[model samples]
Target: MQQYAILTYHQIDLAPPPPAQFRSLYVAPSAFARQMACLKALGYRGVSMRELLPYLRGDRVGKVVGLTFDDGYCNNLERALPVLQKCGFTATCYVMSHLLGKTNVWDIENGVTQAALMSAAQIRQWAQAGMEIGAHTQTHCKLPLMADADAMREISDCKAELGALLGEPVEHFCYPYGLYEARHAAMAQAAGYQSATTTQRGKVVVGTDFFQLRRIPVVRSTFMPQFLLKLLTGYENGKGA
Candidate 1:
């Protein structure tokens, strides 16, 4: 009955605050470092989904949790990586393949900052550093709303593109915005991803879905007590409106 958490984050920086619309997702750099350091202090070892896979198969079952960053922000390289390295941890970055080397136009158009994304070279450096690059679909498409065929194409093609770019098997996927349907799971399975994660809040247990896995969303509102409580207990403290 051993359990572990898969933690998800989007951006890492100390920027005062993003436009009100996107504020919840960015964790200040000082806070991010403190968060990781807290885990290290608690004897938790942050691992990539690549490394945490065996444990999900009823093996390992060690004091390890999966770490993931969505959107493949260049800040994940410029800011997050050093914190991870300092804590002796590895992580997975889910990239929107069709948008590599470009700004997050999807969010930019919505009034968020025009954040830069990791280039192919930066992603390669992440891979070389023992991190994993997972697919977040080619255009960050929401598969739940697309036709099955288009959904399949989105699921399969990003795996193909990133695998080709990295020169290695791309085995992990994460649904964009944690939005997906059962059919999307079927599509991802067909695409050959060994595991996929969702934005749902929970810790990984013996019988969690390998393809539609759950993750705890780490955000700016996740202060130390709340962060530690979520990591240790899977119960997120709700913020009031």
Candidate 2:
């Protein structure tokens, strides 16, 4: 079976000094550049979900890794995009439809640092720059914690809203916090997304569930050797299993 690694990233800027929350979510720009350079050096092409779909469905195959950024951090555009372009890679940035141009309010209670999300124009710039924009939801709410109807609306409406904004269908999704149930997967399918990723640690193999696809995370502390292991071997998949 052909296994593919979909890597997850959150913020691609300098991490705040210690005592800030979710510090692991931040990967410094220089580190990110090195990681991408390493991928290129190894002959792997990092791609967006849109670009990876055919491979996931057994329609095509190659040395490809799906690149994804959660929460639509502005830093992704400011810092990550140029590096991705230089490496000739593309990524999917999952944004909250209703929270564009705002901070991550959903994380306020958890003490996560406030950061700017991409605005509509900035998102257009990303798409125009050959990157992809997927939907996280209308507000980045935890899907399983809400009633089915509310959850369904969050899933379906986000696609519609983002599609309208982009003039193209938003064909991918991600579970906020990786917290979701079976019904939420169905909701994602119902919302017309081709795939939905989670925080699950693993590389995707043939016959993996599209709606609940697994991912390998690249965090602040992940060094070059470990990153290569996660991509080139079954390192992370072993952990998830």
Candidate 3:
């Protein structure tokens, strides 16, 4: 039986930033490089969401994994891209349509500094470099708290805009802040996404819900020992602590 893992990341920076939450989620550039290296060394192949669908249907692949980065931080392009490419890995990057070339306000009210997202051009660069780009909604708003119309608009608009930019169908989505519900999943499906990811920690299996796929969040403290455990043991029992 084939099993799959969805790995998630945010900013890649060295040293802890002022915002404690930032440090908890951010994986430094060097550390990311090491992580990818470890995966490659362990014979893991990074597959895209689209590719994994076939595998989920019992089509076999050798040691397959999926990599996803949420929030579309410029650091993903500046730092993580190189490491991924070095390891011959391709990942899904979910970008907030409204935040392209703009600063994210998610952390502003909390007195924590936010990061700028990649521009449309940078997103195109990643596409050209063989990375799959997915929609992270128009404003990175939490979908579960949104009304039905608002949720529909957010998912539909982002997919339309991204498809126009990429000249390809944008079929994947990630719920902002890892927050999603049954309604959000239904909206994503109606909006034309083939699959969507959530922060709910777990390993993806043949019976997993395509629209509510779970991912393991990789953070600053996610070093070699924990990383190895995550891969070897899976995320069935992880609550992200």
Off by over 4 Å in 2: none
Candidate 3, residue 204: the lDDT equals 77
User: Which lDDT tens digits does candidate 3 get at residues 1-241?
Assistant: 4567888888887644564455676788888998888899999877777776777656665687889988888899999888888888889999988889987687777665667789999999988889999999999897888888998899999999999988999999998887878888898999989999988887877766888887887888887999988887854445752
The C-alpha RMSD in Å for every predicted model, in order, reads: 2.3, 1.0, 1.7
lDDT string, candidate 1, 1-241, tens digits: 7777888899897554544467778888899999899889989899999899988888776888899999999899989999999899999999977999998787755787778899999999999988899999999887888889888888899999999999999999999978888888888998999999987777778667898787888888889988888898748423211
Candidates' C-alpha lDDT: 0.87, 0.93, 0.84
Best by lDDT, which number?
2
Q: Which residue ranges in model 3 land beyond 4 Å of their true spot?
A: 235-241
Models 1 onward score TM values of 0.94, 0.98, 0.94
- The digit string of per-residue lDDT tens for model 2 on 135-202 reads 99899998888999999999999999989999899999999989899999998998789999998899
Q: List candidate 1 stretches off by more than 4 Å.
A: 16-20, 237-241
Ranking of predictions according to lDDT: 2, 1, 3
Candidate 3 or 1, higher lDDT: 1
